[model samples]
Target: MAFRRKNWMAGMLLATTFVVAPLANAADRVKFILDWAYQSQHSMFTIPADDGTYAELDLNVQVDRGAGSGDTVAKVASGAYEMGVADFYSMLRFNSQNPDNKLMAVMAVDDRSALAVASLSATGIKTPAELKGKTIASPAGDASRQLFPLFAQANNIDESSISWNNISIELREPILRRGDADAITGHLTTISMAIDAIGMKRDDIQFMAYSDYGVELVGHVVVARPEYVQSNPDVVRRFLRGAVHGYKKMVADPQLAVASIRKRDPMANADIELARLKMSLDYRMLTPNVQKNGISSVSPERIQRSIDQVGPVFGVDPSTKAADIYTTEYLPDRAELQLPPTGPASSTP
Candidate 1:
């Protein structure tokens, strides 16, 4: 009788071990849908995927280019994805519409508003003041749509006078050729890539820096919901560590970075990638190094500025606390923040 009892106890122990061991062995699967087509604008993301960092953290990951930042929000809010890269405004919109939304920013992708309005060079549209009555092509309902006209008004252009032609980015170049639009207000990456696609020289087109106007919107960011963060805080921290690592590696060696992205998307434009990289290096996009070194942070003031401008158009209250929208808890330690020595960092883009 004693032997039979012992055998039954052993069997129960074995079953429990079997159950717990697999639970311990299971790795998290994380998918990050991008807010837009991959480009140098997203160079910060290369950190986690290429460097074996995510695997070290026990995460299997995939990143899909998104149709818009808002699309990423919808997927994330639906719990269809664990992560996404998106615009600040889209996140705010999602917060308003989804009572259950827990989206939170993990890292700033561009940090700066490197987005711009580029015109074909022969038009002499060098300044925003010159954009009056000109047709501007853009993605309607884009976060920028709310911000761009406010930007135009700051630059002394009557926002209402400018005709907006809603077109898919794939179709923006066609509108430019057909004279349906005089300029495009879009990502700096898009403008550079479009010129590269047509084999056109920068000398052939004029790019008016959006900053020259007043659209101070924060660029894209990596985000996840609060529940996910609570359940996988370690994973989030490790992913951010990898991202910071990748940003340092990319700026240090853009040629190799562009080569890697090209391997993924054969149609990827290398010149624009290089140009965007050069421009990023010029601006503080990857900036505010450590001595004090670490991944640079988004200023509360800057974030508030964008949120304030977006409020009237989007119906969001401008005065909402910045903390209500973003949190920076996942950043790395001092040693991880120092950037490699850049050679004579270029002008602020």
Candidate 2:
């Protein structure tokens, strides 16, 4: 009886050790913050996390919703987060202002900016020229509003001719719906929220994409603090690899990506996120350049042009260079980063 008791105790101890060993060898920890609340466009980040893509690369990632692109950049730069997603232009501006404390964009998420003027079809405000004598409603801090100068110059519209009705974010769409304003300036995904809130049909909305009018600028990007990158280069590489893997999965089935988003923000409407994700993928993410060079990559000339264009607009230091905005050292091979074609499908709740 004593011999049997000893064997049983030894077996239990071995079982406990085996169970604890893997947990002790845990994955590298990374905290990622998004440019905004958990929305459809952020599925690439969330889905990879929810679906275990980060874990597959031995990355134990924690993702948090953010206030805005500027806020996200500040957070990463201040060491509040190890990494984040933010507007590349905003990142560049921040770098220019604080030359010593710089954040480098690892991946260019969208080849073209999704900034646009969204209006009701009834308004017939389709072109930047059409908005010449009209009133535009938007938050004072809105990205599209900040970039309006470039958009205006590209389309040859006189900026002085238009009036900006600086208002709260929630009121921008409502005033437009009531015909109080001619149009609203915001990202396509953000504008879609108002359309959904007002119960407007898709056919009733028109988007004047900045890219369509010769405003060549990169959109959102995955960014990291320069110090963090220098300290953990391998971790950065693994992080980008996991993100690209997750993004590919998202492109193949955006519905699944929406599900992953819902998991993060249970209050999110699936249908709305689904539509937003699809629109973002088609209109913003899947550009001709991205198709050829893969997501997260950019052309040197275009990026340099963007730096030259935005630097003066945002008061960037004359010493700031295009290379200061982003780096390609940590990106995976272009072939591995190509996103598959999106298909017509829905997630099974």
Candidate 3:
């Protein structure tokens, strides 16, 4: 009887090990890259990671910082990273150049373009047309610089009239601050915060938003290599579902988003990041269309219009279709992606 008892115990132990092994290895490891350094906007992924939203979906996702949108696109296209967030226009340009290694945007994050040309209020430049004959500072590959022609065309500013002073990303705000460049082109939220960091008052900076001039362009998107997406459609779907849940949490309590950022970078300023989050929510992420259709969904007509506007600027091949750049196939149902009520609650009185 003792021998029988020993054998039975061993068998039970083996069964338990088998049961736990599959659960331990069940999660699909996914590598995700961000569009830029850690900021409040990146809370979309960090919150999910911290709250185990991705874990619930059996996804073990690792999120990393990125250099830029264009660089993110190149890494995803090369399969160096499985997924990344990037400017949709960068993906369009990449597709035009590297047709064979195409990347596809699965979700639209920023519904409105934050692209803008910022100048000091002291410059007395308030309109897009005022950019004429002004020297603008920008990085060569900046999304704002790349799309300036479209912005100029919309406002009837002669593209050649303005001279570009190509500079590093770090120099954009400083050059504009020193009055070395008349203006600088970059994302409104990023440039605004950078300028404010240099001890400049908010009222001292002036912004000429591209969207104000009839440029109907979409902003950042979540992208992946087409082959990876095709092979792991379910993974793609699960990742997006996790992302939507994160955004909903962000909308409900933006402080939670800031907490996620602070967790990653202890040195990050809670005040600035929180302000950046609100600015992005107000100006770029939470547009009227996003409020209506929910997050991560793009209108086919609007995307086509954006492509039409951007194609001439980037010299995109005329044959490339809008469908080639963006797709809504992997998105969760609209109901699952809706934002919590944004309006203030009625007073109890």
Best by TM-score: 3
Model 1 local distance difference test score = 0.72
Residue-level error in angstroms, candidate 2, position 88: 1.1
Per-residue C-alpha lDDT of model 2 across residues 34-151, encoded as one tens digit per residue: 9999887787777768878888888899989999999999999999899999998888878878888988888888777888888789987767789898888999988889888999
Per-residue lDDT of 100 in model 2: 89
How many steric overlaps are in each model, in order? 5, 0, 0
Off by over 4 Å in 2: 1-24, 341-349
- Lowest lDDT sum, 10 consecutive residues, model 1, at 287-296
lDDT of each: 0.72, 0.82, 0.87
lDDT by residue (172-254, candidate 3, tens digit) is 99999899999999999998789768888878888878887779889899999888988999999999999998888887788
Write the residue-wise lDDT of candidate 1 on 214-306 in tens digits: 666677778788888889888788777877777777777788678757666778778767886777656536544221234546766777777
Candidate 2 matches the true fold with a TM-score of 0.89
Ranking by TM-score: 3, 2, 1
Off by over 4 Å in 3: 2-25, 344-349
